[model samples]
Target chain A: MIENAKVCLYPKNPGEVVRILEQEGRRALILAGGTTASQVRDPGVTTLVDITRMAPPTDALTHEDGEWFLGCNLRIQQLAAHAGLKQVFCGMLCDAALSVGSRPIRNAVTLGGNAVSVFRWSDPPVALLAMDASFDLVGPERERTLTADRFYSRHPRRILKPAEILKRIRVGVPSGRHGGAFFKFARTAFDLAVVDVAVCLWFDSDICSRARVAIGATRNVPWLSTRAARMLVGKRLEGKSIRAAARAAREETKTADDIRTGREYREQMVEVIVRRTIERAGDNALGV
Target chain B: MDIHVNINGQAVAWRANPGENLLDVLRREGFASVKRGCNQGDCGACTILVDGTAQRACLLLAGQAEGRSLVTVEALGTPAEPHVLQQAVVEHGAVQCGFCTPGMLLSAKALLDENPSPTYADVCAALDGNLCRCTGYKKIIEAVLDASGRLRK
Candidate 1:
């Protein structure tokens, strides 16, 4: 409830959005999907800039030159239902999108919202980081691109300027044998994840050439387990290597006690989910 | 602010506060079927169809409803001739407290409209957002399946 909002502007394009944000400064809020915006109680917010109308009307997902571009304004459900993405990365993105809230919530929640809000329980960031996606940001100064690593390095809000907007996400579709899997452990299907894991692997023949292991809901922000990923590279996707990688992920992650679970329990589950996700990703890569 | 929307096949213009949510505005305009349950999005009590897609009204600002088609449970059926889903719920004893019925019906309608022949898993997934505190989900699931069959026939 943006209590002090006295004006809601429906911007027709990015230029208009930037203009409004620049003019209103701290008093303006960007409303995308409104899932997060509806909960705003900030008394300082006096203007709402609605961006739904400015989103790309069609072809939410486009592929060109081996890179996939995802419109930020696309709904989570749309991403879940996208046939192109369903086939990409062994449908890991679809799984993450489907794992978001329920059907109604997914219908209203946008991909940009999920990415920008940066909640520990947010599902897409974990997968996006694992996939090494990049973001195209539009601002009053000039457009800039940031890798998922850099984008999620700090709170996105802190990184983004007042008038900047996340416009599109780009990921290179791996051409060779590659697969990814995302798993979220929650009390219920619709509950916020207690611990979530996403693993993406590229295999050179029977050997793992590259790997990415990302975990969320355990830290302030979802982060890539580089040590765990390093453990998988140059090793065969076998029991010994998988366990070692999972152990690294467990050790690298620092969990805290929350209302949902304890720190030790989360640490234990991280290892389990990481191992299983890696196995699933291996099977996906092999088409087994 | 003035926001215009097509509600239940009628185009109407209404005054809305910039901060007001669609749920409050809809109910204020006499759309009593749109319940104000959790105020938060967890409870699907304020579920409505925005552009034929089921969305929680509480999550949408009233200004965002402009230039969109909105549907409420009121458009589904009348007491004289209830919608097939409504009729099936009553016959299958799915209505207990009936507090979650409207939301359940709307969610079910959205599913059946898209998938005329849905399996048990599909119905379960569709109603996952709407919680039936009366613990009558089994009957409700049964009713949705039955209604899908009836609608197809």
Candidate 2:
């Protein structure tokens, strides 16, 4: 229960939001999408500033050559409906958006707020990390864009400051024959991932040319299996290499025990999900 | 302090206190359709459309809803003249114990509004957040599809 809380509805403007926060100082909690209740674990959160009514970006999704610019308010559901965005990210947004809690949660949920929360049991961070996505973060200082990968490194421990606004996320369309799939396994179907695996596999015929697999819900931040990915880099999509990579992934998993599952078991499940997701991805890549 | 919000289409002032969620505030103001099931966002029982998008009112502060158009279960058609989605559910015999019906209907409405022609998977995705213990929810899925077809014209 919140105490001495106040609900302040400032108009939807970036400068206004910043100004209000600056004025309120530590008393204000900028609530966007209302989806952060699951993400934020603050007991002292009493006052809320609804940032939902903020005006949409006064711009279009300008595609200069190949690169496209998506606004912060460009919701994941809208992104799924968009024909252009569907083909580029290879159904990552649709997959991520569908699995986030429920329909009502997704409806109000924004793409920007997800990254800002920086929870392990999130989908966008893993999906964005896989597709080389970056965010156009607007803060009190100025506007700057940082790679989502860099964003993860910057805040390896916890979330970034509230003043730093996660403006817009930019995802580069995948080039060449890249096959990817994200499979998350949890105790309850809707619960947080016991172990979530996202595999982006590049293939040269049946053999893997390159692969970037990022696993979340296992550690503080996402655990990128660089060693495991290296094991499968040049090897044929056959028996020994797959098991070896799975082993390395299991060994690397530092999943702490929680109410849902044990650490040792979660580590084993990571191997199982990694093997299965990679196998499915490999099959799709091989057209088998 | 009081907040000005547009509930459904009409603008109304909500005397929301601190710690009062939009769901509770709506109930206090005599809009009792917004069910308080789990208090957590996991249950879709407290679902409503904030700015035409389905969201868990339980999680949203009344302040966040200020200035935005909110569509509770009341916003949809009534028993005498039900909305298309409501009519579809009735026609399909989708109401069982009917605890999750309001949320389910709102979820369907949000889905149909967002995507007029969603596939079967889209319908399932729309109902992901809502849980009905008594009913199997298969009929609800059919009802949403039926509503989608009816709304297509």
Candidate 3:
């Protein structure tokens, strides 16, 4: 239904993508995977800048100086199969990748698009927030890096200015005894998450040294409950600590009634999901 | 605009609107095997092999597919000479309405091309996007597994 669009501009690189973004400004829509963009009938978009053509070489996963650099266009299937990612951030990255849509959808969806498109139930953004991933932004005026949490703070729309494109995402490899798990609660495997949770816990022997807990589909944005995460620090991930953190998560989340589920139901499920995810993360940390 | 792509190994030219997708363009070219169940990507009835990878044609703009090799269910085998997978699908009684067959066959073809041997779980996961309302999926999975065994022999 995206009729009368002027052209689907093919940019060669991030700089060219930025230049096109600058030229068209808000009148242009950047097409990454086109899963969401293609279906839109945006009367405002005169041009569709197809950024998939500007993709880096197919082998886009690279490790440099301990940080994992992923091309913005790397398909979800590629990200899921990435050996290095499987080795380090196994459960969190792969599980989120596998959670998105289905096989053909994953073949077409990109990790960057999943995060940058501001889909509330997007699996990767929540997992990336838990992983503390940062994005590389290239703009006509400036280039910068922002943490996953900051990049998604605006919720429904990406924080990128009209002339900026997310070039890549850089993830710092987590050190120490850390375990992460991503869970999506959907009616079926192909359905979008009614609610999802991601937990990354760092433990020093029996004590929890650090924690990151994120929840999606229950708020305007997928949120990293920093307060809840902080509550788990310097404590063992036992029943008492988990209950406190789960209570904090439910308290902090902003939920609303929607067609799929009710506000109270989501709020109630938040406590349950958080408690279970934290316990699963604890088990993962112990290699159990 | 005019875009040229190698569809089913033949270079072809077609006129497309700026907003037209590969699904529209292919259907115009008489590749009816590329069915259009959902213009949106949710339904994989329009699935086709783009560079040996199964991708939804609805999600790909005709311009995005330019200069790339496109494969459709038409390339697999004709009715007179059915592909191994197509034959297996018939033998397993997978086709009920038959609307989801092309996409299912292409998805299974992509998987078997990469992994000649796949577990039942892998077969199910590969065809997850292609929905079949008729056979309830078990027969489709069995067909793919049966085809895999046949391809090996």
Candidate 4:
């Protein structure tokens, strides 16, 4: 799709990447894992700034100051294979990462590409939304961080200026009887999700202290259902509370009929998936 | 544009376009083993090992292969000295029509390289990307299992 491109520059550092993007303006495209590059059909793109060699290669997952930092360049497979991340939030992040297309797709798709290209079927955003992650961004002028809620408020490509790059994703590791779960319902193992849900719960002596319920593929952007989450706070994670939260999630999420499934069916499945995901998270938190 | 890459352990400089995909470039360079099944990322017919990880060639830009080490199914083995995985596939009748075999073999090679003794589920997960309409995957799975055992010995 980048058939009209003229130059492909391998930038050795983020600064070089920023400069090249600035110099090329709309003519330059950043190529990380390159899995989605084939989808680019812009006729104006004439330069490709490859960033695989921008940093010293290391494990993309790192823990610092009670938070997990996922380098934007991290491949989806690397995120899925990280033993440390597998233990985080009951392996919700790993589950979401592994649910992406397939092994080869995961091997080539970067977390940054997945985040920046906000497709409706994207998986990691749902988990990140539920985890309340933050994105670190670097641009020609400054570097800043935005919460996942804000970062995903619109297409990340729109949020990022022409020279801006998503540097890393920061997710706080929950402590003290917390658990999370991600459930993706797809037509096939490799097909795009019909409806996906992510849930995180914190408990204090059997009472739900905090909760986050995020749904994806049902809307243009994945979103956290505050009303659904509110139903769980201060209530025990029993059948009654879980059902109420699931019902709220289904009601609040506005789904549209698509080629994959019907709107009413997706809305109904939302409730089912939310309840199941929350129940799984509750079980994980209780070590059941 | 010119890109330098280590292909099957041999360093080669290849001419390519910035927007062209790796599958077309490799095929044009006489690497017939890298088949083009689905130009999109959905089918893994063009699976190749980039820096020892299996990735789709069709989805990857040719420029992305610059400075990287790549291994296609051509590097696996010859007919006279077939790789154990190839031998197992032949013995298990896994090669019907043989179009997806190259991609499947590379995916399997990647899995076995990382985990020599992969479970049935591991093999399935590893080969999930490469779809085969002929074999129905039963023989392919069995062949991979047999090859894993032979490699362990």
Best by DockQ: 4
- The recovered share of true contacts, given per candidate in order, is 0.73, 0.70, 0.62, 0.86
DockQ of 3: 0.71
- Model 1 sits at an interface RMSD, in angstroms, of 1.0
lDDT by residue (tens digit), candidate 2, A70-97 = 6665555655456676565456555765
**Model 4 C-alpha lDDT per residue in residues B29-133, reported as the tens digit of each score:** 999988888789887889999999999999989888888999998889998999999999999999999999999999999999999999999999999999998
- Runs in model 4 deviating more than 4 A are none
Candidate 2 wrong stretches, greater than 4 Å: A7-12, A38-47, A55-63, A154-162, A203-209, A283-288, B87-92, B114-122, B145-153
TM-score, every prediction: 0.97, 0.87, 0.96, 0.97
Error of 3 at B109 (Å): 0.5
Tell me the deviation in Å of residue A237 in model 4: 1.1
lDDT of 1 by residue, A10-68 (tens): 98788788888889999988888898989888999888888888845422789899888
- Supply the global lDDT for candidate 1: 0.90
- The sequence of per-residue lDDT tens digits that candidate 3 reaches over residues A184-283 is 8887877888889999988888888988898999876788888789889999778998999999999998988887888898888889989998888888
**Over 4 Å off, model 3:** A55-59, A156-158
Question: Which residue pairs in candidate 4 collide?
Answer: none
Give the TM-score (vs. native) of candidate 4.
0.97
- For candidate 1, lDDT tens digit of each residue in B12-128? 989888778889899889999889898889989989999989999999988788889999999999999999999999999998888899999999999999999999999999999
**Candidate 1 docking category?**
medium
